[model samples]
Target: MSASAGVVVLGNTYDFFSRTRPRTVRRLAGRGQAKRARETAEKLLRDIIHAYDSVPSLTFRLLVVEDVATGGGGWTFTAENEYKVSCTLYAAAYYSTQVCVDDVLDQILNVGDRPGSLVPFNHTTTSLRGVVEAGQWVAAGQTLSWDTSQRGVEEPRPCIKRLSDPPIYRCVHEPEGVTVAAIRQETGTVLQITLNPLEYCRIGKGGAVFTK
Candidate 1:
């Protein structure tokens, strides 16, 4: 499927889950029981994923269900509960396929549900240069650049910012002086690197590093 079309499906999936979450939670909390809340949440998410997959044109897979805990809270809910859900969407490209729980939470209170309000996550394509020297190294200190002009393209640079966080860093087109973190030779001419928001640095040399 085309990337744009795939994104539309994803947004629709998120909206569907958001609108149904309240009902699912209520069913799980039948008679105000909290003891099985976590398990119930997990089952509900699995059921939702199955229901979504029945669309014939879409695929939904559960990745994780975490932080499912119950507690006493303010007026609205005497027994407050919190949980996080993560799922993977088989979209157009590998880079566009990862879906986190926060993406769904962002839509939880979206009253308008306007199409314009459903913004896809930020992503970019990156091009790396340099020769892989002895031992599959790309020469220490080599830099990489983000091709912001090619946003939404396949094989995008794996850079992401948390939706709720203050803008601490933003990837730019053609960022300069960005150092290499590490590199693994995927093929004779292609290389791959691991990216983790928490490990943006401290990863060693000859690797790709996304610049802010």
Candidate 2:
């Protein structure tokens, strides 16, 4: 099948098995196995589309690699009879007029666009989480300065004293549904991230911080 903008394309299961599986296995499996696999893949795609629909800012398209010569990185089959579909999720933020400061700070700190003075030691200290938690902002070209005298460190440190620790958004597979597959926001990297929609009918949940 072909994919368009905001469209979900379900690949043919028989084609998938015929190309990927050994000739002996295909001969033994017959048409019934292929039909069952196709149904499972389609159901998984439907669940994925439903979950993503809740997030109005995000749009996605399934990547169906029909040709083995083209490569096969996005597809996955699990023992639990699940088909983990690989897809590209696009954000609407690119067309928005307003800037997302949180995203900007995330890029600066975690994505390698940090300032020269920003030390590599736990860059989370200079992250937006610290700024928002402390109800303060560091001005342009200036980093947070901390007194390390009592702590016995030689250099000045940036810290949010009262805040316990920063929360990390690690890429992990859920028991059932969608999860971030990878993030590629380094110095000159292009694609920001990839998401794998696991083959299960479950709704994805997440939280966002908003400011007026």
Candidate 3:
């Protein structure tokens, strides 16, 4: 196997810019599970966006992960969103829409090509949670808006239909009437659920059922 192919954490998850603990993410990235890193990063970003009002500091660091590939290295700072840079031959700069991201960790931060176009550094003023880790429990403090931001893809969504039983999930928008969806967990540890932003979802004790 290629031992050189691995993801390394370069920064901390709590401090906005602290170095990461080596094994904090080795469980996923080291095992060739890059998707986990991406998901975790996205969740963190969403959490920030959803709960930024109660959040405290913006000075938290990301789990700066460096994924080494055959061509070069892909550097990712896993936060609320996966922010990273790619290189085909060596260190280059390319990012994705992923939740939210910054630059190449070390780069020239500037605004438009003019002093008048210069945009001031933006940071949300509202404040609780800082950097949310994957699998961490986030309080459902606010009512989920039935807008585009609340929707999920055509995939199963986590829900809490029955607290006494294991977690139940469902999906919507296929062809016709309501149908059964898949469940991701064998236990009821999930406290949050996914909502399809495009359609209307009816959530009850039975589970989350949706429609177009």
- Cα lDDT, all candidates: 0.25, 0.26, 0.23
Give the residue spans of candidate 1 off by over 4 A. 1-33, 70-212
Measured by TM-score, how close is model 2 to the native structure?
Answer: 0.24
The C-alpha RMSD of each candidate to the native structure, in angstroms, is 23.7, 22.0, 22.5
lDDT of 3: 0.23
Off by over 4 Å in 3: 1-31, 52-212
Between candidates 1 and 3, the one scoring higher on lDDT is 1
Please give me the total number of clashing residue pairs in predicted model 2.
Answer: 0
The sequence of per-residue lDDT tens digits that candidate 1 reaches over residues 20-98 is 2433333332322232333354354334323322222222211222222111122232112112111111111111112
What is the full ranking by lDDT, best candidate first?
A: 2, 1, 3
TM-score of 3: 0.16
Segments of candidate 2 deviating more than 4 angstroms: 1-21, 65-212
* Lowest-sum lDDT 10-residue window in model 1: 87-96
